[model samples]
Target: MKKAFLASMLAAACVSATYAVAQTPVNTNNGAAAQGPQLSADEYTAYQAVITATDPAAKATAAEAFLTKFPQSSVKSTVLEQLVAGYAGSNNVPKTLESADKLLQVDPNNIRALALETSLLKAQGDSATDPAAKQSAYDKAADAASRGLKATKPAAVADADWAAIQKQVTPYFYSAIGIDALTKKDSAGAIAAYTSELKAVDVAATTQPGPVLQDTYFLGQAYYTSTPPDYLNCTYFATRTAIYAPEQFKSTFQPLATYCYKKFHGAEDGYDAVKAVAKDNLFPPADFATSVKPAPTPADQATTVFEADKKEDPTLTKTNIADREFVITNGTTEQAEAEFAPIKDKEVKLTGKVVSIADTTLTLAVSDDAKQANPLVADVSVTLTEAPKVAPVVGADVTVVGSMASYTQKPMMFTMTGGTIEGKAAAKAPAKAAPARRAPARKR
Candidate 1:
């Protein structure tokens, strides 16, 4: 989460040219040029020492000395700003942070200083070991980022320059704010902050691996974990991240995309199309909700499957045992009677796993609904003509031949009598031998 610090860029840029008092006044304070404020010979000499320094370390030292020599100088804020840039460019962490604090004391809303503060504090929070220390750093980061959001264009920076500066720094501020909120478990606040960040940054940035891309994924998580969860929005944003995530990280985001899609739409049938659309757009399209088809409810599925089954086998002729079980169990009393009447007392062949067994009675789970139970339950009750020589164990796959007798609709069990096991029964596991008893120990 380290930021591309603006101060580092400013460092070399600051020392590249001599300060022209005409075009950009060196003695400006709070964005207002002083009325011909003249520097003393000594002050001018010190100012030249700072502005003419060829390197960040030298410039920082010269600027610090100049500020110490002329504490009440008209260009104090300017010197502090450059000093921050110089320390930042030289990667002097403590001095960079110190100079930024100094700059903020003179101009509380200095955009560059606030940005550096947020970035440095956020980095500190990320690496801190103690809970209190991390909390303190994140709190400070959020505060600085909040101020950066409200920072106005300095009067000295032209309109065009201000516009470019905003483009550069605004997303960084919002991202910091969002991260702090996310860490605090404030989902709504995180969502708002990250949304604002996406709005502020170049759309293309969201597709790259960095603050914007990471925040884009975080936005999805915030939406998903928010109260009463916004699944569709989560799907859209997460799908986008999965699509653009770097190869090593691609798998990280796809599962959330699929899971949230299924949760919202009731199935993952059309998620790829959504992903296809998300790849090119920053936000979901207008028809997003209407586009995905929600899967049928359980009752709806039963009704549809039953009706199709009835049409396919009007007289129950050639209807498979699984289909017969479905219509009889789930269909209305009248529909159940219509299907069951045709096959009454007729022998049928069924394939399923054994549910339970006694000497001459076998219970079998013969339908999808029956087999899906936590502990498999029987859909068919069979009274065998005689018990098999080798006992059929529970959960052993077998084929049963029996005459259909009667059935109950609720909790759906069909009674069948004069049954026989017709195929190879699943092999039983070999019995384990008892372990040898330990020898009695001599009295201690």
Candidate 2:
């Protein structure tokens, strides 16, 4: 199966990478072709000569010149691939990534282009400060890894080389799998898959890493992104109930964190390297030193007495903020406003089914329909008091109540109110007070 898979991929790779080059043969008839933009025999020969040029500088210059002269060359993919490699080798990462992306744009499934793009994106991601952008880079790497796995040609690849490619690409596949598993809140499964990928990288790194090592490093990063810090010290790193124990992950994860920190912040305080991001993981300080603040004593406190007639009005729980809405109480649309208004400052329980989950918010539908109404017609969406360990699946039963509430447009949203996942129950109606009164009437 592996062989067959690789073979199919290789065929795809050829179509994407080399076929165009094969088609654009040099016209041998001297001036047979018009000199609009097409390559003549001499020009094609010159191009190939530059591709094979021993001097890196000369090759780059020649390739650039060829591209400038024949911007629409039929062998564009080939030219782009060579440029990517040449520029990358010259430490021109930006240009290398640009060329790699261009190659992908032309033939997205090209194996070499996919491989190059993955490496370049990973590199870029490592340097990015924006978490969103960094995550995007990792996503692109995962995509390239998928393409590389599918672009292999088993028939042409030597057995050893094929195995190596598998070792290299499997982490990408597993990294993606881990991310998906996390999305579903399958912590054990995600940790297992990510650990397997990390192990694979370790195995591959024993030799010259090539790409597998790079993939391993990025897999660790993705793991960090998907994993919640609170869970990491607890369930994630606990026992080997899933994949490896926390101890095992220490070698890769700690180093990865340190590397990421160092790369992002030069010699700054490692613990406080990153600026305060609301969503960033807050690992315990290594030395366990807590900064203590002075407390105000009763005698030192400033106090004021209000008039006997003074009154305190209740605060509004749900209000509009910017654009997005928030709900403090988790309940059906019909009950949300009332439920939140009375106990805006107090804790409450709301029940609903999952509708959708975005980065920071979860949309839930209250199953209010008895027979004729929509199941989620009165569903209410709420932002959680704490971010969920895993994204809840659509249609899953859930209950959320929290303290903060903000109103929104459309289906009207309330903001964050403190809450918990009370168990889901059927939206069954109360058993009709069964004409039981008829028996009482008889007694009367």
Worst 10 residues of 1 by lDDT: 435-444
Clash number for each model: 0, 24
- Please provide, for model 1 over 1-444, each residue's C-alpha lDDT reduced to its tens digit, 9 standing for 90 to 100: 232233323322332222221122444233445564557668767877877776889989999999988999877877887788778768776787888899899999888788777777776776677878877887888899899889998776789977876676677678778877888889999999999989997788788876577678889989998987888899989989888888877788888988788877775567778988899899888987788865554345445655766676767676656656666665577767876887799987776778999999999887655666769989889999999998777888777888999999887888999999885685652232232111111100
Which number leads on lDDT? 1
* lDDT assessment of candidate 1: 0.74
**Deviation (Å) of 378 in candidate 2:** 33
Encode model 2's per-residue lDDT on 257-318: one tens digit a residue. Answer: 54433332333253332222201222223432222122222112211001110122223333
Against the true structure, candidate 2 has what lDDT? Answer: 0.46
